[model samples]
Target: MTKGGMESVELFTSEGKGRGLKAQKEFLPGDVIFAEPAYAAVVFDRTSTWATTTPWGATDLGRCGWKAAIQRGTWGCWLAVADQEPAVPRGAREPMASWLGLEREGSGLAEGCLVSIDDLQNHVESFSEEEKKELRVDVESFLEFWPPQSQQFGIQFISHIFGVISCNGFTLSDQRGLQAVGVGIFPNLCQANHDCWPNCTVIFNNGNHEAVRSMFHTQMRIELRALSKISAGEELSVSYVDFLSLSEERRRQLRKQYYFDCTCEHCQKRIKDDLMLAVKAGESKPSAEAVKEVVQLSKDTLEKINKARMEGLYHEVVKLCRECLKKQEAVLGDTNIYLLRILSIASEVLSYLQMFEEAADYAKRMVDGYLKLYHPNNAQLGMAVMRAGVTHWHAGLIEAGHGLICKAYAILLITHGPSHPITKDLEVMRVQTEMELRMFQQNEFMYYKMREAALKNQKIHVMPEPSNETSPSLFHKKE
Candidate 1:
């Protein structure tokens, strides 16, 4: 497959399934790996039309590949026949049916569509106990659609996703409802599912509006790899930070929907707690003190600590957080990602008290843990590094402080370009650092001048100010 000078991607499928991306060369942490405009993207909005029933009712549907794919899938729809050739008129009412085709300006726009081979690699699912309790249903929402040339156009429908998995991670969604016209690399970044402690990261480049770009030196084809250090045959991973779900809740959902039991360390630890909690609760028999104790220890204690922190009780927050860290570490281990967040907050309180040396040490430790777990370019990691650098400067380690500040500035530049709020902050910090250095130098110079004058026993005369009185007028008054 070829389109002009664009290298058309081919899916490396095995047993009717897509495999993960393989590295063509060694990639650096901040390197721009790959970027392709999304082949097809419909903004997830209230206006997205979904099928009331499967698409089998339409008779003219035999001409489209989408309809055939649906027939091959588990769900089926009735085929509807069009009395005349279907035309996509603007604002045409979407029929009271399920699944709609993309509207085209004309036949020319239709030819520009890019539906990749592995577009249907995975599906969305809702597996949380909370969600299940609310819906009491096993199924969750998903997107399906016809390509640009489908006959279902008279219906005027668009497909979309159900959750808020921030489209900021994708090259196509730099802005709301803005559509970019390139296809995603099939199963390259796709196989890497979401994680809080992802061993891999995706960097999109190549589009004019892309987040970051690394120019290629030679006329060579580029390949992609995990941005972070990974083992020889480790499973690829990416952060699902946009969801903000708890670890247990995320694992539950992933297991229910994705089908493969995630043996990721985070998931394993979460399942262990869940199993233990279940056993303890079962033994308590509703009125047991053990069950009540477990519940209070888990939720009530954390809630109280959170409330105290919110109410500005810094002392209580420090104490409770320390206690919580001890308990959590006993169960979750010191290396747990959540523990790093707790330590980071504690360092902030220390900084507020002007305990810069202690704060710097804690901030440094927090940053080290984050770098070990998360990709360096992540906003949180950048912030932690910035905090540690400032703390070191405040503690009077000028050289070490500047080094950390320089690193933080570089990371921020790569992760968040010049237009980002963090980049603006870094500029302010650079100016402030220079000002401090200049002031220190000026003070040293003045101190030496005063010392040399005193050692020489020299009388340094101060310049006199002009007298306020008019001497001529006073003498004339006497006359």
Candidate 2:
């Protein structure tokens, strides 16, 4: 596959997973796998009308609301307004209707709440009397603002949209990585299967400055990249759930939402390890009182650090983080989750303040901690390594920086691929560090040569004074 070009991948049937993309050729780490625009997207804002009354608090209800919003471009009372005046112009509505209808039909919705679209037709049919009654209230509240377009059609439409959103929506976050701003439906990205240890990741890019002037005016695209080296015929997978949690927790979450039992190699190993740990815990667990004390202390420290950060007291933030780290380390050691969390905070804050050396220290620690706890090719490890490399570079540790960057590049090449902005940024750093190292060596060599010549000239130009016994050479020459 060509660098920064189309990836060697194709869609195929994934075992256990309905459909998935597979690599068609060998992929190196940091290669761009593929880029695609979202099929449909909506920016999330808490202040929006639907945000006020939509039953999105419940997972199922939220999924339903997302689908309705995406499909009709409005929810609740707005749907009624659209029905009457048709907010979508005639020319636009036709195409939208065609797309939504096609998507809805193909979404595999079924009538039961078993997390599949295939059972959507029997959804109401299978509902218990209590469930049906509750659903009626939800549907009525959803339509409270809308004029009656057609009760039967509205009910069916809402149900189908709910199933589709539950199955397809992806959380959208802004560039800042602060919080999720919205949810979107990316048809192509939705095709990739789930793996506890995913080999690919999806990133969203909102267009340039002018484009971001208005939220609605901006165009967003989702990019998919290889997280690790994927051999030809290897299935490309992304994590659908947080993989940081233990295998049991991850499996439980996936089963609850996606309705699938994960039998992936990572999950299997984690499950086995967790079971073993549990057995050992029974034999040599810590004292309950001691554990409680440590937990409470950690919690209090974390709270204080968060408050300081919110108040923009960065110095306090760093100080608190360090204190927390010390306490956690003394009690739980470097690999403990709490210690790792504090280390991450310290690294980020220090980097933000341009304290590169200090940041590098914390980042290095984070990398080491992640390495000890996570898989070799884990995305978090890649991120920590990258941070360490960048900070080291900024701190003038050119060789260390270069080596760390290369290491990070190798790992990221497999997990994030080359086309990703992150990988691209790291490449820039790698080249820069290489150039800096060369210049530094050249300057050092020139300085040493100049010093050597200066010393030799001093020896040659200086004449030895006559010895005391021969000082009167002119008068004692005869003697």
**Model 2 C-alpha lDDT versus the unseen true structure:** 0.55
**Candidate 2: where is the Cα deviation over 4 Å?**
2-36, 45-152, 175-179, 205-224, 228-235, 255-261, 271-296, 442-479
Model 1: per-residue Cα lDDT over 1-479, one tens digit each? 00111122222332222354333344445434453333222211123221111233312222222232221111112122233333222121121112322122221222212232224332324334554332222111112233345543332112111111111113222211123211122223443455556654433223233221111111111123244644333444565342123457666655554444445566656533332233212332433464444345545555775676667786776676677655554444333445555666667766766667877877776776656554466644665687788888767655566667777887765554454445666767867766655655678666445545654695633222211211111000000
Task: State the lDDT of candidate 2 residue by residue for 1-479, as single tens digits.
Answer: 34432345676778776667778887755456666544344442434211211222211112122223332322101111121321322112111222343344444432211223332222344444765565555455545533354233546666444444445666655442334544455555666788877777666544333222132333356666666677989888887765556678779867655657898988887733332122113445556565556657777887887777767777888898877666555455455556666777787778777677887888887777677666677665776787788778766666787888998887766665565566777788888777767766779676445546656686433222211110110000000
- Our model 2 lands, by Cα RMSD against the true structure, at 19.7
TM value for model 2: 0.63
- RMSD of each candidate? 20.1, 19.7
